[model samples]
Target: MPIDDVSAGHRQELRRGTVALACLLRLRRPDYGYALLEALAADGIDVDANTLYPLLRRLEKQGLVTSEWSTGETRPRKFYRTSDDGERLARDLTQDWYRLDAALRGVIDQGES
Candidate 1:
C-alpha cells in the first residue's frame, strides 16, 4: 500500500473519536446542524454533513444531546445542545485527551534523547 494511503487510514481512525468529542464540546451552546458544521470547521474540525447528521441523531438517542425545532424562521431548523450527561462526558474526555497528549509528548521526547 502507498505510504500516503496508510497515513490517511490512520488519520481517519484518529479523527473518528475526536469528532464526537468536538461535537459534544461545541454543542454546549445550541446550534442548528449547518451552523454546527460551520463552527466545527472554523475550529479546525473538518466533518462532513453525512457524518455529522447521523452522529447528532445517535447522540440525541443516547441522551448526550437534546434538540428542539425553531419555527420562527421561514425555514424551521432543529437546534441541538449538549445535555448534562454530554457535558460530563466532555469534561472527562478532555482530561483524558490532555493525559494522552502529555504521554505522547514524553514518548517523542524520549525518542529524541
Candidate 2:
C-alpha cells in the first residue's frame, strides 16, 4: 500500500471505536438507519449503510439500544434509541474522550517545541 493508504488505514483504526459512541449519542432522539446515516455524516462521521445496519443490530443485541417499528407511516421504519445502558456508556465514553483529547493536545504541543 502507498503511504497515503497506510495513513488512511491508521486513521480508520483510530476512529473505529468512536462509531459506537457516536451512534449512541445520535440515537438519543430516536431515528431510523437512513436518517442516522445522514445525521452522522452531517456531524463529520461518515458511516456507510452496510456498516450501520449491522452495528445497530449488534447494539440492540447487546442491550445498548432499543428498536421499535413505526407501522403508522406509509413506509414502515424501525426506529432506534439509546437505552439506559447506552446512555450510561455514552456518558462514560465522553468523559474518557475528553481526558484523552486533553492529553493528546499536551503531547502535540510538547512535540512542536
Candidate 3:
C-alpha cells in the first residue's frame, strides 16, 4: 500500500477512541446533534454524523449521557448532555490521555537520543 493509505489507516485508528472522549466532554453543555457536530469541528475534532449519531445512541444507552426533546423550537430536536457518570469517566480518561502522551513523548525523546 502507498504511504498515504498506511498513514490514513493509522490516523483513523488513533482517532477512533478520542471521538468518544471528545463527545462526552463537548456534550457537558447540552446540544443537539448537528450543533454538536459543528461545535466539535470548531474545537478541531472532526466527526461525521454517521459516526456521531451512533456514538450518541450508545452513550445514552450506557447511561453516560441524557437526552430530552426540545419542542419549543419550530423543529423539535433532541439535546444531549453528559451525565455525572460521564463527567467522571471523562476525567479519568483525560488523566490517562495525558499520562499516555507524556509516556509517548519520553519514548520519542529516548529514540532521538
Candidate 4:
C-alpha cells in the first residue's frame, strides 16, 4: 500500500472516536439531520451524511441522545438533542481529552529537548 493510504487510514481511525464527542457537544442545542451535518462541517469535523446518520442512530440507541420528528415545517425533520446522560458523558470525555492533551504535550516537549 502507498504511504498516503496508510496515513489516511490512521487519520480516519483517530477521527472516528472524536466524531461521537463532537456530536454530543453540538447536540446540546437540538438540530435536524441536515442542520447537524452543516454544523459539524462548519466546525471542521467534515463527516459525510452516510457516516453521520449511522452515528446519530447509535448515539440514540446508547441513550446519549434523543430524537423526535418535527412536522410543523414544510417537511418533517428528525431532530436530535443530547440527553442528561450525554451531558455527563461529554463532561467525562472532556476531562479525558484534557488529560491526553497534556500527556501529548509533555511527549512533544521532551522531543524538542
Candidate 5:
C-alpha cells in the first residue's frame, strides 16, 4: 500500500536538509544545476529542479558554493563547485550525519523488532 499524503509530505520535508548536504558533497566536482539534480535523483535523493536551482543560488549567496558560466560549452551553462569554506563545512557536517544516521537506524531497528 502507498504511504498516506501526510506521511509522504513529512518524509519529503525531512529529506530537504539531506539534499543540501548531498549537493555540497556531490558538487565538489563541478556540475550544473540540472546535472546535479540528476545525480541526486540517481543516488535515490530525488529532488525537483525548481527546488535545486533556488537552493544553489542560496548556497552561493551564503558563500558555501562558487559558480561560473561554462562558455566553453556550445550551450552556456552555469557550473558550481563547493567553495573552500563549503568543503570544510561538508566535512564537519558529514561527521554529524554519521551520528544522525546511527541514531535514526537504532530507532528504525527498534520499530522493526
Candidate 6:
C-alpha cells in the first residue's frame, strides 16, 4: 500500500531543504550537476533532477556556490564549487547537525529505556 500523500509530501519537503546543505558539504571539490547528483546518490541522498537543478540555481543566486563551464569534455558541463562563505556555513551547519542528531538519539534512547 502507498503511504498517504500528505505524509509523503511532508517527507519530500524536508528532504528538499537538505539538498543545498548536502551539496555544499559534498562540493568541497568542483563537480558538475550530473556528477554531483551521482555523488549525492552514492552517499544516499536520493534526489531527483527536478529538485536538484533548481536548488543549484538558487544556491548560485545566493552566492553560496560558484560555477563555470568546462569545455574540456565533448559535452561542455558546468562545474560548481562551494564558495568560502558557503564553506563557513557548511562548517557551522555540520556542528548543528551533529548536536541535533545526538539530542534526537538521546530522546529515542530515553523512550526506549
Local accuracy by lDDT, each model: 0.95, 0.95, 0.94, 0.94, 0.92, 0.89
lDDT of 4 at 62: 97
Give the higher-TM-score candidate: 2 or 4: 4
lDDT score, candidate 6, position 17: 61
- Model 3 C-alpha lDDT per residue in residues 9-98, reported as the tens digit of each score: 899889888999999999889999999998889999978889999999999999999999999998999999999999999999999999
- TM per candidate comes to 0.95, 0.95, 0.95, 0.96, 0.89, 0.89
Measured with C-alpha atoms, the lDDT of residue 43 in candidate 3 is: 93
In TM-score terms, candidate 3 sits at 0.95
Which residue pairs of candidate 4 clash? none
Better of 2 and 5 by lDDT: 2
Error of 1 at 85 (Å): 0.6
How many clashes does each candidate structure show, in the order listed?
A: 0, 0, 0, 0, 0, 0
Give the runs in model 4 whose Cα sits over 4 Å from its true position.
none
Off by over 4 Å in 5: 1-3, 111-113
User: C-alpha displacement of 104 in model 6, angstroms?
Assistant: 0.6
Q: What is the lDDT of residue 31 in candidate 4?
A: 94
Q: Candidate 1 lDDT, tens digit per residue, 24-97?
A: 99999999999999999999998989999999999999999999999999899999999999999999999999
Model 6 worst lDDT run, 10 consecutive residues: 12-21
**TM-score, candidate number 2:** 0.95
Highest TM-score model number? 4
**What TM-score does prediction 4 earn?**
0.96
- Higher-TM-score candidate among 3 and 4? 4
Model 4 residue 59 CA deviation (Å) reads 0.5
Residue-level lDDT tens digits of model 2 in 1-113: 89999999999888888989999999999999999999999999977788889999999999999999999888999999999999999999999999999999999999999
**Residue range 1-113, candidate 5, lDDT tens digits:** 35698898998888878888999999999999888988998999989888999999999999999999999988999999999999998998899999999999999999999
